[model samples]
Target: MATPTIKALSAVIFALSSNAMATELRIDNVKLYQPAEQMFSAPTSIYIEHGNIVKLLPSTHKQKVADHVIDAKGQFAVAGLMDLHVHLGSSGSNYTNFQYLPVEAHFNANLYLGVTDIVDLFSFDNVLTEAKQLQQTQTSPNLFYAGTLFTNPGGHGTQFGGKAYVINQDSDIEALWQQHLATNPHVTKAVIESFGGMGNTLTDTQLAELGKRSKAANLPYFVHVSTLADGKRAIKAGASALAHGINGEDIDAEFIELMLSHNVTYIPTLAVYHNHASESEHQQISHQTELLPVLHKKLQGCLFDKVPEPNVWFKTMWQKRAHAYQNIVKLHKAGVTIATGSDAGNPYTLHGIGLHNEIDALAMAGLANGEIINAATINGATTLAVDDKQGQLAQGYKANFILLNENPLQNINALHHINAVYKEGVKINREQLAERNQIIQPVGQECNANITSQTAQAVIDNFNDKNQWLTVSDSAMGGGSATELVLKDKVLTVKTSLGKPTHFGAWAGTEIRFKQPNDASNFDGVALTYKGSKAPFTLSIYHSEVQDWDHFSKMLPASEDWTTVKVPFSEFKQFGFGNKVQWSAKSITGLNFVWRSMPGTPPPVPNNEFHLKSIGYF
Candidate 1:
């Protein structure tokens, strides 16, 4: 509920002074969150030698004066927080907006929030390698990562427009795993989705094969799922963990038994669901604009859009989150290991900062403050299979913890009230971090300005011949709606009717691909012609085969007359959050036409219909 203020970013005329470090360090008379008892320990003196916690002694005991000693009372200490699910290298300002933020910004975001360790579920392998190295040389959290997200070709992973390992068949599993291992990742990530609830997932044989190969390699594998069916299927296929909890349903007895018996860890990632709720509660952003200019432009655009009334889909998502939260409590009661994963670096989920929200959400799901702390700390380390080295305060364990101004055992929100962070016996300068966050600018890459050309042979589909286009709809998941691509009289007709209420909406659509993925680098825009009845509908175009869930969209104006809609490459923003600029026209994918209501508007009328004659680049 704390709103970040402009003064948080205002320039200050103070220099950062260093915290003196020594070979031996003592933290005396501080309340400790004891993992063994799952409660705060009495005032204790923690002795550290050579970056390791060496002793937990009675504060009253007289001992050799240490090389450096902190205060003698009235502070709380807990194992530094760990976020199990995060995308450390992602800008996350938008769904498809891409930016390469400085490593320091990421470190500052987590450290400022008292998160001293993080496990990134997906990112480019090289980027993860760099982040791992940065952790040792800089004052950053202990970093762990799953090198890349492996999934079916053109599947969930492809929507992000990033480099990913595509699993076309069983053979791809070993190949992708070997390539990933070359980067020395701590875990592997895979995704299973029904194409936004409109398509199909990989065959059972394929999933089993992937799971089999992953287990054979003796590595921890995390599978991403959104529905109960997929979650159960993934577990049966031998997934080591579920990256996110299922929505829209409760965790039934079967789910509880399967996970408990299989020993599969569950990362609820409630932060993402809470983000959807926050989006529905648009008023939350009105007072935060003063902090906007300090962030990237794409982030600014996303914030601007959230200031409007809640959209129908966002409202559905907000309500659906309750179901997921309930499932988390059920799973925890069934003895399923619950790890706190923020799914950060997604919309509205800031890295490092978002983890606190996840912890808060877990508390709301009926977890005690001690249990929540354990989930955020050791539970995450256990999920990442690195509990031996990190996650707790004990002799031989890494001397990593956060000094808190208040006891988090009494109030979970106290986790955000960070006083100082000690990683491996070295202290971080909080004032210096504040200054860095205030002055840091976004490192977004600009597109090439000189690249421009017109498409001479631009026709993609004339609707005169048969082609492979698959329609997907929310009905696949439980929504009520049917859709079809009917080509008659040399025109393609897209028709739909309202179905049951669903968070994603009751609609149908398909992705149209070129003969081969066209790298339309020479072209600069797309031109399409269409006409529709008096129904509210939208047309989306995927300009390239980038894995980004982005497209150029325009409302198909309702008219008895044919209308020509041209979406210039420059006009396309990534989920309405990009700086409409330079882009590669090559690799143009397909078009998706759907009947859905826009946010802050009434639901669409029944029996929506539209027609398309031609689509091509201009």
Candidate 2:
């Protein structure tokens, strides 16, 4: 016979490994938390087979046959936690250095914190699909997503860049529903808030129509509402769940009765509000090993700094935090089904750790430790419509649980004392997970070696090297915009569709990022040759001190004929909520030229074009 080949030998080894992993695993001498009963049971031996709990034997039982056995020594075992509101595409905060980390890092962070499952309320379709596929090849949390957020044109959901299904008075509801169905979403989400006059919202008729379609397809309809009025309207319009805690006002008995009558679940994402009000919890976990190194450094630097003077936004956030806490207590006392959703990927809410902060917030809101655990587990599973097989530590359920050093029922913070974590009967290799989730280098870093020293007259771009330019559109934030860049004859042309503007309006632009930070202090300002559409354009400057979207920008005159515009550095002003700081121009990162429309601007027309011949500092 011929000698066995290397490929065949490798295949045989893989098969043997698979068989070994599939063998029965017995966890002995562990106290299990029974979610259904809201209590812990006596020490027991859990027999797991094929990734499901097959039996729960008494610790002293005579029969103990299994392929693998772990002596737990009386550790507490509970169903792995679940975070229902997350945006896996984001790194929790845009201000952090790790904002650009790949989505896999978020998954690994969740698993490290013992979150066995997550539900992404809104994200781009491709991102959700890619995350779903990663589940098969890696040790990741079970991911469920609501592919597209159904909102009105220029609504709250549309403010983020992906394509939100925008409903207008003339829209074909049935056609839109068919398109939404094509995305194969696990849940249907809609925005019903006016967002404090920031944008328009879906009408009751449109919401009811969408809810009817969702029910027809056997999917739960969840609505994002901040006010008690919107909460009532959502339930009346057939919402299966309210996606956030009511913060615009205190929830009263009437609203509670209405919710009870409609059997709507309440997902109070209190951690997000609490994070805005105080960064104490975030500061405590800034040094965690599970966090990527860059993010860890950024957090440590900012979280412990002396508190700044309270601004209007800060005061508003504190009020909302108080309202959210009070409202959750009222809702829980009224017997409402309160689920935990951390709203991770917001400003300060870290993904995996956000859930723990949410639980702590729930406890601070007067929920008992057992009630908080129930909210973190079974209630979240119920909201996802997966409680039948998940969110419980019992026979006939998936063997997904966390082994804790102490019982959480007695002290909720004990949940943080994780001894080991298991998902689908297999122990997680946390060190491997961290290694696989290393932070991704920022875009354009590879060209750093090619960067030359800059002087006052140094050229940034001459439109001849197309490789240095990148096209950007509103889609990056979830708007309906599109952009394309073409370079020819030493001139760069930008083709753009402004798309539908959100509350922030629509933007399409071209950007050139520096491979390394540039010190442009010697230069007075930038001079660029450009000719574009009649719509106004902006020249935005990015630097190390500004992390959010509120970069310093100066408006450029719209010109039908090519003109050289010189903008002095003194003219640039901070836009949006960025902190006011002195201009240094010492660590410039990039520059952007964009066409933007304000809220009242007419709906955009197609096929807009612009051209840039040269760009440099004078």
Candidate 3:
């Protein structure tokens, strides 16, 4: 370690500060864990300027007074983990597309989760271009977002997420290439989910055009090929990578032969797979790891008034997804590139925990510890075309690494025992980072009891009154622990539990139960107090039962600070199932909520997490 110009601050001290100063990060007394090399260096001090890492100095020098200093005694530090297939622009599988954060919020969430980099796999051109700007400015984790996926005209990502879209028949190779590159996206995707995960192969001309054009533009292409058919096409089309490893079906040795032949990277979002796996071993291992405390706590909070069987799909997936990765292991040994992917913000997986779960699943895949680290660090960086400065521990490489408590080379689980995470040169305290990285919780997990004063007022209004009633997104999906809810004055907060991009996208909204014997009339309106994204975002109220499947009311616009909006009751409708008989909803029991693209779609009715202050008759 080289000598530092000044001293560094420690985690214990940073945790005690009344407010974060937001610059100058220094870390000392840390054993750096280099996963790529499978080695741990002795004690060293790291110096950070702004948020980027500036230098790695020796701990022998007396530390200086930096803005933030994290003490990493008896701990290890490594690069912040990266999730390749994470989703934040939308909420749940319904694709209300609301979880995308204000740039600052997203950055802070990723930082806490120890996610130094992220690839929002399915964002739109406008949304992604903006995020790329933030990344360049270093406002958030190094970001790489594909503007939107390209499925067959009516394929999967097109209708599912309400993301930006342009139809290109596989026949129009030139038009296809032009449209994809127009977004200035990080990567383009082919929605394989449309073909039941087997994948709808774009024609040879289309594939050849993609290879040529992307290569010409210096922008690589990625595909969501979750099956053998898709895997084969990605190879034939020369796709740079595949999101989510081959799942649900067996991979023939011939397919493995093909992947290695094309050098196409495979990102198995193992965490999403684990959440949906049905096998006991996978479940037990997932539960036994350090991620268990956070994962279980989140799932437990899914109950809105103890509703039964919510988030059951998560457990069921975990059980059924057991054998899904057998082929991935063969690939690992076959010298195929199987990178880490969390597919965070899906129905069962959130952010920070998603990375942890991915690491765990990778371990189950029989990967060498060094290989897993490479997958998250170098491999992901390679796919993003930022390898020049993102991965590795070379002097000129951006100062990004994680300090582990144990040698990951010895046991892959050591990745979870994070002591510190350094981005650029600034070293973040592991504990502080973990607290912020936690994004979403499971369906029945506990939740923060905190609520903003305005939101509290709403909760109280409903609580004290006998007739106050409402419906909401999945409770556990809404907020992790009741305790996480915080309201100072009227501004509400949704913070990450990890130090990077691990945790993000949990919102809460309420729907009123039309229990009035006379049948409750429509709500007069809804009130919201929120801190919008760095740019702007949309908040919407849906009066329908179909989550992300029905027409939605107008979206209330947003701003940077805590602001309020009152949606008109005219915007409300009788969602076919509540107490409004004759004109009443005959079966739809709950009115759902969702968040739309800040400058994008108006979102279909979907039960996404929304932080609310109040909803009622004006």
RMSD of 2: 8.3
* Model 3 lDDT on a 0 to 1 scale: 0.55
Ten residues in a row with the worst lDDT in model 3? 495-504
Give per-residue CA lDDT, model 2, range 1-618, as digits (tens): 899999999999988887665438888999999876788889899999989999998898874567888999999998989998898766664343333446777788788878999988988877887797878788889887888888887677766656878887736677778888888888899998676666678888999988888899988899999888888889998999898878656788899998878888888887787664565434434444334332333343433343223334644666667677788888888888888888888756777888887888898888888889989898888877898899888889999999988778888889876778899999998766655544433222121123443433468888665458898877765577888988899988888888766667788888888866788988888898988766677889987566556788998777889999888888999875755656777778899988877665754555578888888887
Which candidate, 1 or 3, would have the higher lDDT against the true structure? Answer: 1
* Model 3: per-residue Cα lDDT over 407-502, one tens digit each: 777887777665455676655554543344355332221333322221111222322234343433222321221113334444333321211010
Candidate 2 residue 616 C-alpha distance from true site, Å: 6.8
Q: After superposition, how far is residue 425 of candidate 2 from its true place, in Å?
A: 3.2
User: Distance from true position, residue 535, model 2, in Å?
Assistant: 7.7
Candidate 1: segments with Cα more than 4 A from true spot: 1-23, 95-100, 216-218, 279-312, 443-618
User: Which tens-of-lDDT digit does each residue in 364-391 have in candidate 1?
Assistant: 7888888899998888778777789788
Clash pairs (backbone) in predicted model 2: 160-477, 160-478, 161-477, 161-478, 161-479, 162-478
Candidate 2, position 462, lDDT: 85
Candidate 3 residue spans exceeding 4 A from truth = 1-29, 42-74, 91-106, 129-139, 161-173, 197-201, 276-300, 303-322, 428-618
